[model samples]
Target: MVLQFTDVRNQSHIRCGLAPMEGVTCFATRLWFSLTSQPDFAMTPFLRVTKEYPWKRVSSMYAAEIFELKNAVSYKLIPQLMGTSPDDLERIATPLLSGAPFVDVNCGCPSPKVVGSRAGSGLLEDREVFAAFLEGLQQKLGHDKFSIKMRSGFLSESEFPALLDIASSIKMAQLTLHPRTRKDRYTGRANWDLIATASRECEFSVVGSGDIVDFNTLNTLKNFAPNVNTVIIGRGALRNPWIFEEIRSGKSVCISRNALLFSLATFALLHEFQAHNPLKLLELVKQGLFFTPCLTNENLWQALYSRLTTSFYGTEQPISHLCLDKPTFAKVKMIWHALRSGLGAQFMHPQLLRSRDFCEFEREFLNIAKDYNDLIPLKYHSEFDWIYSGEKRNEKQESE
Candidate 1:
């Protein structure tokens, strides 16, 4: 049974969400997050709706998987769709809309591939078309059934007020603002001031995203923006699936090395059972290990890299054997680095490495966290001190 938006809002606590991420947040990962954490709602990664596309075609197989995820999570799981025009949405949204409890429009994807096609945040570039698209959606699926996920603007902050006006006119069930322009991508700090401003300007509930990876930030956001009652977490949840549980329970979260391995083992069993592909499952583990923030301990990177390369699921042979070609390893390293950097401004940017160095990085996985991996590492808060306290600092500097 799915909960309505009002039902979710009426809850006493601040609502937490697993944000929609294209490659990282899939059914398997969502299941892991739901079972391991306390997200009140979760969203499937954005589905690119195209006309007469084979991959977009809905199947019972896919529906059954969604059903299984629903059974596992036992909460609101919204399916998000992306398209350039209303025609694309009308053409390809049936299977998903029919199966989902509620639907979301994707207007905030910043990938060049998505933007080049004028589909994701690209829609925001053309205000007239975007407005018409929302109007058509309301006509097609009443006001209560859908929501919109968007960035502050396409290329500039100037576009947001106009965009917000159009979105509010439709009475969208909710509006989730990522608070960064497409130009910002995920490198800079998220503009929570814009989120707070939007909450004040618009009548609908506004959900904030970006740079919220721990309980402290969650608390800070709640106190900072009393109007912005919900937050959608992507990388934070991936790094520590127990984050939500810790936030809701208000307890310090400490994971022993064995407990962490045991949790991954359980996730591996479920992922393998569902995906039946060791290669894909291995990639997810690597992503989790790399994206999760770590303290600057001498052994932390070594332990993490080891876990990234070796098969932790206890398969007869290591997952490295499943890689069809040699070059895949290099691509994995580059991709993981980029993803980690994209989460916060302070993180080092990812760069391609020489093959030998890449192998060395892989081999460094000599030790997996021999010590416990605390989800709420002390420095996690310190890393983003600028974000939570920048306003006061700026005022002091001005006074000086």
Candidate 2:
């Protein structure tokens, strides 16, 4: 059965969404995952609904990425835009509302550059402006089925009840809380209790966001916050696309090294395509929540990073093949350093990649992109084909 956010105008209101990350989540990633992992919606990478780029690096955030998403793939596309002025929002909403089926306002990105320029999560500090931005969107879109992706609060967790109050007053279509204060950023654990309590106080459809990937985590948090009917995952989805299936089935599927590599390779191909060329993201991966120990070793990390930066999925086999020296944490960190430095401080800033200890190489796959014959390694794949199932892939097929 298809999961939905709400039944608005009889159109599918997307429930599962790819959270918009400036540098990390791009058009290619969305198109690839929608077909392979097939999440129900892809929000725009925190757009600045203004006249110009807030930061010099991500001019790609010039608008809602509406046309790009439409041209790339099909499912329900929700273009998220961020701006302080309703006029600026209206300028962006005018075209997107006419194009994309779903739309959202970003009140959750916790970057200083975003907050400094009064976009993304920064608007949280100004309730009146953010509210007006929503109200303007509500009037333009002609429905109450929009969403706001946000962190817990600006100053304190105690501010949640009032935040929910302010949200309820505006009569939002849905509220998605990332559950971490901007100050905590992505470091601290997300608070499900706050979401549960907010759901208790409000009648609006509430979706919980945070570190939700594994079925157990989803089950635990869902049970604890029974009021939250839907969960939005960002980093978790990168690790396991079948997470939705796991949640629906309530059973754990044994994940393999090959499977993880396949997912990463596909994502890398799409990432490179979207950016026109893969910008090395060694920095982002180090800071990326997507990397885990089992899925890779050292050589494997370098292989995929090379593929992404250079457009190689390493091996096109239906199943993955790992090496003894594959993606170790070091290789993964190396990839992060290469990409993060070039992408600049849009969202996944290089500054965030630093940690106290150096990560070691974990998996084994060599950087074949250095040699043309290296493509020979990806000759076979296992039974794990598409990460996601059904219509989304059909849509990708039809479009192609």
Candidate 3:
């Protein structure tokens, strides 16, 4: 389905998409968000294409999840492929296109490994290859059945103009631009002006991404680039799961402590089932529930803490029981780190992070949450420093 959002002023509609995040936003995470706070569309993490495996084998891994969830959910899940060869991309994308509304080519991932292979943002480094790849894919799949997601440039902003020129000449369903160079990684603020430039220049729909952390930021982006109707949220969504709902409702939705707990529980359960590995649960906990400051309100935390330790309401086990593991404790510590950065909270709660066992971890977690209950919930702005920090320097060294 075409993603559409009503613009009350002009009686028009704009589309919304969930940004594809690597190591996060997997099937279970997407499914949970679809059920909880549905965005118009969500892009899957890039499916790496390689010659070692046949196209059919590579495509089969993602086909089941994409087909099963498309009809089951309200949002559309588009499969994104990352590779340098046009032939490899076309072969893999053929099966996915049949099940998905559209397939997206990921030309924007800044991961060192992905770029080293001359895929992802590496495509931008060579203008001819980038143009030919999109042109060839368009010829095979047709313009309306597939799309492109990309960054402005590879090493510098100077490369953006030529890259945009090449991309705009091609016909596609939509083009999502993150407006940052591969070198920038996730350090500086996203350049919205470039998005406006793209909207003005491209014939197709343009989806703006990056730094969209709240309802206000969403509004600011729209105001900045009025023609760029579609937008995507990535790290921002992790900071506040209810962001999509908040944007749709046009108000700040205060997440209740119980709601927060339930969300964590639901995400954990879904992730466990999807991955089929209990240890894999730890990854989601660290990445998924970074919105810890949501429970800072005093009264909410008090009531929530009581129910959590004593007997969680409407759950078979207490919150402590669910969290009596290294994975859960790591998640708590990650949240604390988010809180420290977002709110400038001085207390790191070192004891909580230093907890030796699950029992101590759980106890320390509760104590820390209780101690910080008096703080007010502040707007979270994710710099995404953890993923991309010092990446450019390392990449430069690697290249040398």
Candidate 4:
């Protein structure tokens, strides 16, 4: 299975992977992806390189913290770097890939921020600069070890063959294509037709991304895009964490309510670990939209008010008071609304502070995160490290 990176392994062709999406795919989710689904290879979300501070701190500010974790779980964690200049790329690349293997260059991210900076799929418009970026990456990271992720092209599938030619010339370890032009974004159907064409055109293993959500969709793509080597999943992975397991074993997973709750609690626990500043904790918790996914459905306001302050707070009944209100995953509009309003943990699970037993491990663990440094730092270099350091500092200050 491509999911298993060992070259000589018995399993073959079974490559289940998670697509990298900004603000969504982080180490916590990466852990969930591998531990839960066991994808063949996971692509680190795009980390933009700027000339701001060289390799001093994180690029997007929030990007590097998630990418570089001390105990980065267990699995093949592939880091992706996106930059316009070879210098900026090398500047961050040195530290980003310090002890990492299999770095991937992103030419596929369609975010407006990415395109505005000319780092992601926008680079597809200029093949020369694009090739220059890859050649430089190859020179810095070596030829066979680095991979590249890209969309078909800017306008049409015409540029895909050229894109493959460039990837081939660099001897890229692998190529993952999200078969839509910059024009379509996520609106149009993924150009599986173009993916089929490029799979045959390229010598390297090609990974197909776009809309491989469920077991049926995964199976459909096996025949539909025979040319591609693996299937890459994005939003679907968030909506259904068991995607990899379902695809690999030829089984469909019924996402249970308990499953969603477990995911929510544990993810908050992980974010709380990395949290140094309260706002940071709140922000990362906000990203865990997939876990408690149901604020935007019907009766939005009622759900919001309930999730925030129920019998869990004030002169009211115990939160168990409204125990029956928390429905099994029916229509998740309420969860959706909360996520969009603010990616703040305070909003998503405001009652967490009130519950003595909501998530005990999280409560004790989050006690450490309660330090201001753990959330949004007043002045700290490594917010991730600050979580532990802040605890020590708080203790010292108290003793003093």
Which candidate wins on lDDT? 3
Model 2 per-residue lDDT tens digits across residues 1-400: 1126442321212245666767646555554455433465666676776666432333433332355324433345666777767666666566665665445778888888888987767766767776676777677665664567777788778766666677766655677788887776665468888878777876777778886655667777878787676667776665454444445445544333344345445454444443433333323332432232212233544454454433233443322232212223233343344322212223133332442222111222222122323222111111111122112445445544
lDDT per model, in order?
0.61, 0.53, 0.66, 0.55
Clash pairs (backbone) in predicted model 3: none
lDDT at residue 276 of model 2 (Cα atoms): 39
What's the C-alpha lDDT at position 324 in model 1?
Answer: 22
Q: How many residue pairs clash in each candidate?
A: 3, 43, 0, 26
Model 1: colliding residue pairs: 303-367, 305-365, 306-365
State candidate 1's TM-score: 0.70
Model 4 compared with the native: what TM-score?
A: 0.64
lDDT of 2: 0.53
The residue-by-residue lDDT of candidate 3 on 1-400, one tens digit each, is 2345443422124566678988666766775565446677777888888775454655332434466333445566678888777678778878777777678889999889999998899899999989998888888877677788999999998999999999999878888999999998887679999999999998888999988877778778888899977888887776666667667766655543344545555555554444344234233223433223222233443443444334323455554566434554454445444433433243344675576544465565455556454332435543333433344655545544
Residue 59 lDDT (model 2): 46
- What value of lDDT does candidate 1 attain over all alpha carbons? 0.61
Query: Which model, 3 or 4, shows the larger TM-score?
Result: 3
Instruction: Give each prediction's root-mean-square deviation over alpha carbons.
Output: 7.8, 13.7, 6.9, 16.0
lDDT of 1 by residue, 1-400 (tens): 2233332322336788889987756665665565555467778788777765535575332333345333433346777888766666765565566667457889899899999988889888899988988898877776656788999898888888899889878867788898888887765567778788778877777888887867777777766578876778886665456667667766545544433333443344434434455445435433443233332222443354345345443433232233323333433343334322322333332222332433343333213232224431312433433333234556435544
Question: Model 3 compared with the native: what TM-score?
Answer: 0.77
